[model samples]
Target: MDPRILDLFCFWLLLSSLLRLCSAISSASDHRYALGDLVPFYANKVGPFQNPSETYRYFDLPFCPPAHVTEKREDLGEILNGDRLVHAKYELNFRQDKPLQSLCKKTLSVEDVRIFRDAVRKDYYFQMYYDDLPVWGSVGEVVDSSGRVHDRRYFLYTCVHFEILYNEDRVIEIGVATNGETIDITEDKDVVVEFKYSVKWKETNKTFERRMDKYLQQSFLPQHVEIHWFSIMNSCVTVLLLTGFLTTILIRVLKNDFIKYSCDEEIADDFDESGWKYIHGDVFRFPPFKSLFCAVLGSGTQLFMLSIFIFMLAIIGVFYPYNRGALYSALVIIYVLTSGIAGYSAASFYKQMDGVYWVGNLILTGGLFCVPLFLTFCFLNTVAIGYKSTAALPFGTILMILLIWMLVTSPLLFLGGIAGRNSTADFQAPCRTNKFPREIPQLAWYRQTAPQMILAGFLPFSAIYIELYYIFASIWGHKVYTIYSILFIVFMILVISTAFVTIAFTYFQLSAEDHEWWWRSVLCGGSTGVFIFGYCFHYFFARSDMSGFMQTSFFFGYMTCVCYGFFLMLGTIGFKASLLFVRHMYQSIKCE
Candidate 1:
């Protein structure tokens, strides 16, 4: 091993140790499950409770068979108490045509408790609720003496169990002795008894996912219908108003400029006032830092398309709110599947820029985002492991993720890069570049990079601000967000807001005789992500009460990716919009 590499690893280990020590010493390392938290359970799924003809899907919850029918069942593991939405419910699979008997062999016990089928494993211990507090009671302790039930029965508060089967269709009774003791229902025959069971399940041998969306971490929401409307209408109005103003400016001002420049020669002198015509060539010249730009543009394009499709799936009811990490799993699968799109966009854009070194561009495009994601994941996982939290991915899962990236995604990217390199696009500009670079003149304060970025990002950020709050709360706080339709609408508005803001900023820059619009266009539109990160930082302190290093690391680690992806998506939108904006305006005139 290289000495420097070894040293670096040693240093990383030391840093990790220090961080864990600091987390331990910090005052906020509590990991206790809060009382009164709602314990969600999964209903046992059997062969088509409604229509016995149809096969069972994971989402299908089986209903109870008719009274007096006997059914044998298998356990989907016992339910357990967990933090947030960190746990999942396994479906209790029962033998076909099995039903609980109307009358079974009588027991000598005072009360016969239905033992929910489960042969326990160590991942999640069964958590039964007594007086709304979690206890490690098994299936036989069915009717605990605690009373949270009433005669009204507004909520059916217990997990539905299935009657399991033996190898033979024997008429064996579904009876479970209560370990040793029994609860006599006769003592409280008239009393209402409420019992609860929560499931924290996983696929057989599959471990728990380390981090889950905060909004989905719980199954509770305090939102009213009016608040949903408020979030949607606020964003819609912001986008509509900005769009209206831009439309008016374009129609009234640009219409006359186009007419005058096209027909009248004398008024054409005024067209040279700011000389947007002077740097038409430079404006369209290939942007510098070609590889990085292509990478950003490519990744952004893929994400843009992926987001639209994902939301479409959500709108169509593919991702349910309590579907237990289905959304995240789908996203990972999509990103891997879309690797080719990213590669194509990067290579094609780079080639169009007249950039050589296609291999370098491809490598950069692959690593630019993926590497950061891996590093952040490792950091968070390390923290989770240090804190002994269930939110840490085991070594096997991490290795599996790496294998997927390397074996599956990498080859797709290479194929895409090869295909895109063979494709060609011509750059159409009204003017030609001169041998010497144009000397740009100084501009007003608002036209400067900082001011332009702030203003350009402001409107777009405002458009999604309300939705963003909900999204963050869902990811970090205990909130359940299932409004996919509204989310899709807000996202479209945000895209429009970003494009218009970038186009406006680009126009101002060109008007000021500043030809540095390449990076400016990117920064202006991408700054919305910066503001988002800023808001997240503020939320960490102002809006959120989350504490502990493990939580903090997990929060920020994912936030970084979200912010970066946003930057790419919006920056690509701005860059492309500016190109079209310049082409439409300059090409309309006889600048050549």
Candidate 2:
């Protein structure tokens, strides 16, 4: 590979990103609106990654007030930019409880006030209740006592405020209704009057209050459609770049002869019918315990990365709710990006195994990947559409999914398929297995079975369950997108750790005269996914606090993603180890 090519590739991608950002800014001017003082205010909602808005206050009106109204008026100076002077005006509306006079014959006491406040607190939208409901809550308070003293005297005044969180897809409406209606022990019909508070912009300082509403009304806002477009462009570009890189690597792999060549035919006569390698007419087998140890290590490395990448993309805003095809979009993106690891590991394994049927290898690997994914999608889609569930992908979204597969994922995958065609390195790593193998009589029962080896991989994954829960919670409950940074780091750690652990266990297995390298490597490396699987279940049943339908959907959705990731990891590391072992065995025999 040319260093300049890599440098130039990075440079081009960076430049493209910068250009996209600039384009976003250039279009911003057209969307700007003039500020006014008397504009009517609407409730603003907070969203992931966006800051809260600090403008107009919000108060919830009852269902029976006939119509809503605003009260009180205040003008906040003006900002003069060029020919325009924007003045800000505020209004507050209060209603007197004249109708409540019929129900409340006596003055209200503190105890009644407490009961009313408690009831309202539990009943009303307490924590942007609708906005963050089912997951988290917002900041706010409640009233202590209704200040109504006599028949005509109403003692409660409600202060309301709206804290705008984000401005991405839809404007979130979060209202904090606090401090109103204080009554005595009896449940009096306090006419329960509601008030409105608002602020708007104005062109002039004089009559700013009157003009404020006009300013707000005239302020033109671009529909969420534009933002969604921007996000799509950015996501498309990123996916393209990643897909392109994978394709390049895959193409190179397919072209390489040594990497593609399988040794199964050449070595067929040398092995026993039971698939055991031999030395000096004796079965050269690795102790079962050591093999399992190696598999777990390898699998762990793969799982860590798969999880991180999936979450990172989610957190980075690429798959936000505003995007119509977020789930499918994510699926395609992750699958394509994953090809690099898959190719490297799988190809590396074939080399070790001295395997035959390169074409078979390629087909098997790709099929293993695509089948599970298609099924998962089909399942999700069926449930979503048949049930009119928000979870289903729309036709347009399905097109997006196709675009991701055809334009992004398939291309990269095809390249990986090609690259995996070659099998040159003979062994994945430089290290070679020694000849005239020293036989260790010691053997463990756990190493012989596939289940036990798989279990080894499962153990370490358990250690990291706590971290996995945080990731799940963030995605499902919080609905936050954009987790790339943390994901990248986690991936690095998983890869390095798996490699290191495999190498360590391999050394031990070798010293112990355990030559059953094939399954051992996979068992050691693939175990991580098992651990992740278990932890994911634990999170679903025990750790997660999410309630209702969301809980069920989130659990299954995330589980599907994690399970796929696990299989990929197992395939990669297991394959790599097997390849490495084969090379070592052959090298030792040739030298001897």
TM-score of each: 0.66, 0.49
CA shift of 475, model 2, Å? 1.8
Candidate 1 accuracy as TM-score: 0.66
Instruction: For candidate 1, write residues 1-592 as lDDT tens digits.
Output: 8744553454354345333322312113232223223222222221211111111221211112224332222111111001221122322222233232221122322122211111111111232221111223232322334564332111111332323222222111122112432223323123233332222222232111212232243433434546767877998888888788778757876787667657666766666544576676677776679899899888888889889867866776555533434455556666777788889999998888888898999889888888988888788776756754435555765675676677657777877888898875755566777666788887778778999888989889988887787787766643567777778888888898899889877877886678878888989889999999888998888887665455667677789888998998899999888888878888777765
lDDT of 2: 0.39
- Candidate 2 residue 323 Cα shift, in angstroms, is 10
Highest lDDT against the true fold, candidate: 1
- Quickly count the clashes in candidate 2: 73
Give the alpha-carbon lDDT of every model.
Answer: 0.59, 0.39
Tens-digit lDDT track of model 2 for 1-592 = 8744553454354345333332322112222122221223322222111111111122221111123343322111000000111111222111111121121132334554443343343322311222211111222233345554332222333333333221222222222333433322234444333333322111223331121222222122123324334443443443354345434533563233223232355664454322122231222333333322322332334344555655655555444322222343334434555544444444444444455544455444544546665686677566545534334444665664455444444344445545654644553333334545545456676544465545445433433343454456545443333334444444444454444344435434543446555455655665676667666667767865444343355357647766666655654565455455445543443221
Off by over 4 Å in 2: 1-33, 37-331, 337-360, 419-443, 450-455, 479-491, 507-514, 547-550, 574-591
